[model samples]
Target chain A: GESVGLHLPTLSVQEGDNSIINCAYSNSASDYFIWYKQESGKGPQFIIDIRSNMDKRQGQRVTVLLNKTVKHLSLQIAATQPGDSAVYFCAENTGSWGKLQFGAGTQVVVTP
Target chain B: EPEVTQTPSHQVTQMGQEVILRCVPISNHLYFYWYRQILGQKVEFLVSFYNNEISEKSEIFDDQFSVERPDGSNFTLKIRSTKLEDSAMYFCASTRTGVNYGYTFGSGTRLTVV
Candidate 1:
């Protein structure tokens, strides 16, 4: 079975510092990947995404790096802030299947 | 900006009872989906709908579960007989196109089966 997993379940960083969250996916057929931020009481919000053909994509203060060869993905947040504290999930879309598979999620905390 | 919206933020039902979770996806979006997350677990995909029909679904979406776009704006998921194991947060999402495009997800409905 195909699975997407994170390297860390929780990560803590200081405000103004950079934060990195890593994810590994096992499905080679996955063509698209997305990063979502979820607050305690809200649904997941899309942050950034990358296609298999591209190695990286950047959003406001977020960047997503994809290594198709290693089947790895990472989300980098520049100048982390308290508002950036949330559970982040990486999702992969296997082209063969239309459904998007989500990882268990990584909890990110930013302290001042 | 327009976003997905779900009704009945919370639901509680006894075992063997039926429950329907409703969602209203963004008007311009063409794809609709349902996903669930058990307490402390990963979010799992249940089903995807497009063009008034089901395009894909996961094994978790078994015979007990069914999805329908009964009206122009409403997408509903009905569980024939709820069970304890069915308790989870159900999220509804919509995308302008397919999987290549990111989706907009609703706040989700918490279903509790007692």
Candidate 2:
């Protein structure tokens, strides 16, 4: 079955340090990828998205990298803060459809 | 700042009972969808509605599940007969025209079946 998965279930980072979270998806035909942040008991908040044609996209302090060759995706957070601690999810969209298939969340814990 | 709003933040229902999760999607948004997150699990897509009809749905959206944009702004998901496994957090989301527009999700309605 086609699915997306995270390489790490939890990542610990010191405040002000850079953080990188990785995800690998099985669907090679997917055209768009998005990264989302979900606080406890809250819905997913969109962070940044990258199209397949673009290898990287930046927003605010977040950057999304897509490696189509390996079907891998990564999100980089600069100056990680305690407020940035939340479960992060990566999702893929196919053929201009908004039906998002989400990967298991990666829990990010930042300590000051 | 527009938002998708869901009602009954939490609902406790008995097994075999019917439950309805309601949402008010962002006005002017054309696509509406329902997704569910079981405890400690990834979010799963259920169905997508456009132009008052279902454009797509997942296998998880079986005969027991249905969606409707009964009125102008309200969209709803109904579970005909709830089961224990049906207990999960239901999230409603919507996006304007293009697929580039990622969905904006509502907080969610946590359904507990006993």
Candidate 3:
């Protein structure tokens, strides 16, 4: 079975520092990867995504990096803020229509 | 901006009772999906629907679970006989297009089976 997993379960960083979260996926055939932020009692919200064809994609304050060679994916947040503290999950779609397989998730904490 | 909406933010039911989770996806979205997350666990895909029919479904969506698009706006997931293990947060999501667009997820409905 294919699975997506995170290297770390929790991450802590300063308010103004940069944070990077790493994920590893077992299925090399996965063509699409997405990062989601979930609050305490809410559903996951899309943060950023990158296709297999591209190595990296950048958004307003977030960036997603994909390394197909090692089947690794990472999400980088610039200038972490208190509002950014949440559980982050990485998901992979294996050519299924909107069907996503999500990782265990990493909890991001920003220290004031 | 359009967004997905789910009903009954929280539900409480006894074991063996039936439960129905309702969701209304974005008006124009063509794809609909259902996912569930056990407390502290990862989100798992349950099913996907399009064109008034099921396009894909996971093993978890077995005989006890079913989905339907009763009307143009409502998509629902019904569990015939809920068990204690069925307690989890169910999320409904929709995408404007397949593969290219990001999915918009609803707030989620928490089902607690006692």
Candidate 4:
């Protein structure tokens, strides 16, 4: 099945640096995208979301960029902190009824 | 902030035993969903419920699995005759409209079938 995928399985970033996670989705029909952060033993926490009509959206310290032409999405975290160390997933909603297809997560390791 | 709540943080059950996972979605949300993630895998949608009925379900949600909103507040997933493959982290989520509105996920219940 055509699915969402990440470019990197793991990302190492120094604390206080900027971190970027990239994802590629194959389903062109997908119109909604979201970024979530999952810590150990916890549920996925919503970070940011972007609709296909928009190219970019921003939250507290996170930004989601969507490129419909390339079927790509990216999440950027500014001033990465140790608390940001977690597995990040990119999910796309292909249907209006709303079932999300999640990508293999990118493990972000924030190093002090 | 309103959030989804799940009960039984973890469960250990023998194969062929029945298990029920419970969840309390946000009070005002209209849509409910169940998703599962196996070890080292991405989250997979199991089922979606609306208006006290199942709106959609995935292939993994076979005859052994069922969902119900028996009362007005509690949504439950019952797995009959569990198998080892049924062991996974099950997460409950709710949204006001749909995924476009961003779903709030519960901490999840980890089920282990032996």
Whose lDDT is greatest here?
Answer: 3
Please provide, for model 1 over B28-76, each residue's C-alpha lDDT reduced to its tens digit, 9 standing for 90 to 100. 8889999998876778999999899888898899999999999899999
Model 2 residue B11 distance off true place after TM-score fit, in angstroms: 0.7
Residue lDDT tens for model 2, B26-104 = 9999999999998777889898889899998999999999999999999999999999999999999999984578479
How displaced is residue B36 in candidate 3, in Å? 0.1
Residue pairs clashing in model 2 are none
Please provide, for model 1 over A2-52, each residue's C-alpha lDDT reduced to its tens digit, 9 standing for 90 to 100. 444534388999999999999888789888899999988678898998889
Query: Each prediction's DockQ?
Result: 0.57, 0.53, 0.59, 0.55
Q: Which portions of model 2 show Cα errors greater than 4 Å?
A: A1-8
lDDT of 3: 0.92
**Each model's TM-score?**
0.94, 0.96, 0.96, 0.95
Give the per-residue lDDT of model 2 (tens digit) for A37-96.
Answer: 999899999999998999999999999999999999999999999999999999898535
Worst 10 residues of 1 chain A by lDDT: A1-10
> What interface RMSD does every candidate have?
3.8, 3.5, 3.5, 3.5
Estimate, for each residue in A1-112, the C-alpha lDDT of model 3 and write its tens digit. Answer: 5434534388999999999999988789899999999999999998999989999999998999999999999999999999999999999997567789888889999999
lDDT of each: 0.89, 0.91, 0.92, 0.91
Candidate 4 i-RMS: 3.5
Residue B114's lDDT within candidate 3 is 100
Q: On a 0 to 1 DockQ scale, where is model 3?
A: 0.59
